[model samples]
Target: MSCDGDQHTMQSSDDVLPPPGDIQVLLLTLDSVSLSWSSPQGLIGPQTFRVTWGCDGETSSTRVKDVHHLKISSLKPGEKYQFNVATEGEDGRQSRWVSASLSTVLPAPDQLTVDSVDTTSAAVSWNQSPGLDHTQHHYQISYRCSGTEPHITTTSSPSITLCDLKPATEYSVTVCTVLENGKQSQLVLTTFTTVLPAPDQLTVDSVDTTSAAVSWSQPPGLNQTQHHYHYQISYQCPGTKPHITTTSSHSISLSDLQCGTQYSVTVCTVLENGKQSQLVSTTLTTGSCPEGWRRFGCSCYYLSTEEKSWEESRQDCLERGADLVIINSEEEQTFINGFEPDSYAWIGLTDSVTEGTWKWVDGTPLTTPRYWWSGEPGGGTYQNCGEIYYISSGQGVWRDYDCTFSQQWICEK
Candidate 1:
């Protein structure tokens, strides 16, 4: 062909530059990559290299002269990229392209948060790393209470709930992203404290006309040495305001309560930080009368079994925080009559202060509807105190009796 002519001729394929060989990724990071390659086999003179990369349908390229390494920056984190390198000759001829595929290191998760904390559990969540597919990645969570070993768990979701945590405890939590290839990102850390635990097994130990005794099991892990916390008890009756008290003891006696009422009692743990736990509640009904006393209407009555003089009986009633029974209404009179139909009992009515002027124990003058036996005041000054007498016919009537007469009596409060 004609080497005789002086005109320049087209070069053969043998003269064309070969592609770069052995493309290697030297380093990969969250948002960049460093790459290097062996220059085409000898026979090259002042060659330039063209490097191209693409990800998510976007492509970019750069040219470097006399260099075997290329550094790519501003790449998206946690993304896969395809790269190619070729050699360029002085005459503008390019070699075939050499290719490689690589994935950038995943980035740490962001905005770590803990919420919805209770005595035994909490919910944690975070924003996943950008450019990573949620379905192709998972999250690893590690948590621990103060002075305890760590616990680890995994979830495909960005959010997870942790259970069986200790109450009123400070916890450290770390979250990280995991790739399908088992690669993990740096751990992001946060801390939160669980709410205090509530008292359990609340019960009314004892109840009476005007007071109640209540007890509960202390919250788990609580000890008397930890004096920073205490139990708060609150009680309320229908149509009344709530009453509150705090005690270090597990049992408390509540007083000044109304008789014959239903009370709702709630107990909770209060921390030094002013945090209160969930409320544990119970209900109880108070008895209308104290032990050995009978309730009638709004009053409590006690009938003495031993016989005594009128003055001695009044002294006993006063010592018992009561006074001799006063028959104020026909209903009361009938009730007293039915109590002991065949026995005589001293009543509150008496004329001892002034003869013939009957007065009740409360110093109120006795009025109409009086039940008097026929010719009852016949004893005159000798019998100045009043008493209830039952005839053989079982009819109860008021009769004058001596102050020293020995008879059973009734007390009212």
Candidate 2:
């Protein structure tokens, strides 16, 4: 071939009409289309094929690339479309377009099943897209409460579970097929919502000091989630406001309650949806201590006071169903001494008759002395008896004074 001056002489190669070979396009699957053609023997180089595809008469074209085949994707499922491929040559010459008309694919029947739904959520499961090539393309799933765009897509298995939805909500979900080319198929809506867990168990256990323990269990049901228990204890004293404790635990310790008092207790369970269970209630009793005294060591005794000498104080205690505050050890002696300060009283120990000797009325020999205040047991001519004196309220000191001197005293029973 030679080029002439203006529109040069170019040799015409019009004699190459190979037998018309079958060039057919078939819809192989939802995500894939096949284009097969017979290769004519005499071709100088690889052929460039362009495919035009679209739905509802809307057409789009792919640029020419050096390949005998081209695939069209992102078509709607159960939708129909037509496509044509054309060949081009080195000098920009083109071959006649080979066209084929076919429907993209039929959508698979959705696997619709109802799952448990709670006050705020529902759970749904469905079958995967059948038309998508298990190898080349993945799926994108979208859902909406109504007809709208921008659905949610997930690559997870055949099922998806949603959360944080409105209580008693109805949601519509659809899955679209996406290709590596970023094209997406039509939406396949799935109907599903999360289900709420069942009511939990409510329990209360009694504790000392007007206290009680409470606990609960998770609700029972499919897709149970975000379960918790809410608890409170309420009690009323005759003339006092009700005491309340809000906690998530099954038990709490209450203290400083009036003896012989009664209290009420209650418990409830809570769900992630903010729905709470029915509260259960029970009663408890606070036992009693004797009058004008407190309970300790399972016994009640009057914490009374008397003013008498060591012998007289002992006789006074014996007359009043009690005993002179016995000082078995320094601890008891110091305890009584500390009961009152700044006032002198009589305790059970005295060595009035014999110097350097001490004894309780009960004939117990005094081995230890607590708070032998300032030169105690001076063995001088004046001091003889063990005197209990108070330096302050609830604080006391001891001294050695004449046994007959009148002093205040403490009594216990």
Candidate 3:
């Protein structure tokens, strides 16, 4: 074919068909462009083709020789362009711009990216090369029902997120680049969705008078996999102070609690993404010792009779399946003194049946004696027996009363 004057003429059977060349315009991307064309029959065996393209009507041209494809980089986004191909044949050059006009695809969604995902919300962000000038562009960010969006568009913001989504649902999404020029490109798909909140099932293993053991399970939903949790517990026991502890494990031990008290316990789950679950609460009972056995020094002790001789007190305590009070330290003497009665009661100390040597019924030596009332145990001629009697003053003291005197003898185990 030839371009003579206004149009070209074709020979009978030979030049009837337009030159057989395949032309294609590929939008390499927003920053680059590629125009490709091939002639299965390029003149003869090893004939080469020259490809050229530019914005239609522009004087500048880019040329690629020999190869059938031409990749042009640094092209403006959203710009319309055209391409054409010519062959170097044995009959000199053949043909003019024979193919139709073509345009580059709008640049892939600019600044495409995900910002954040939460239990009930997701934050997405992106930036676009708004043509030659920087301006807010329109974008349609479509998301899958579960994960991140696969694509993005131009007219849309560099980012946008779908709201009010079900927790833990898988989603696919894409941003459609809507140009200010009103061109809508193919969808850019990305998959994402809102994450599930922490688990809600929490409970106490058991409650004691002063403390409770608590436990809870992870939330049930998507994204629970491959994630660990932290637990925070808060509780209150009657007549005691509130308490709290943090742990990765589901259980905790609480100690030093008051007896016969009602307690309230709450537990909350912490998601891997730093989200906290609702607090779960329950009521429990703290373990307590029996009545009248007030805990002192981690043990229970009581002076049996308000008034009894050392021997009498020992027998009384023995009848109750206990022993006459064993005084361990000065602190204990001070403690027992606080419960003093008007009359003297027998303690475990004694020098009866012999003289000048004190011994406990259990036969333990007194390592330390506390508060012996002034001028104690003056065992006169026959005062070998132990007697607890008040002195002239209000203070009480022990005296060696005769064992045969019949004064109330105290007994312990």
Judged by TM-score, which candidate is best? 1
Q: Which lDDT tens digits does candidate 3 get at residues 20-107? A: 3777666456545566676555355564544444563442343344567767665545666555555544454445554545555565
Per-model TM-score versus the true fold = 0.55, 0.30, 0.39
Please list the residue runs of candidate 2 whose C-alpha ends up more than 4 Å from where it truly belongs after superposition: 1-102, 106-109, 112-124, 131-135, 143-151, 161-172, 179-186, 190-413
How many steric clashes between backbone atoms does each model show? Answer: 0, 36, 67
Residue 158 of model 1 has an lDDT of: 78
RMSD of each: 10.9, 17.0, 12.6
Error of 1 at 82 (Å): 14
**402 Cα displacement, candidate 2 (Å):** 29
Better candidate number, 1 or 2, judged by TM-score = 1
Clashing pairs in 1: none
C-alpha-based local distance difference test score of model 3: 0.56
Expressed as tens digits, the lDDT of each residue in 237-327 for candidate 2 is 6677887766655455666565456766555545545655455666666554335554333222344454556667667778865665655
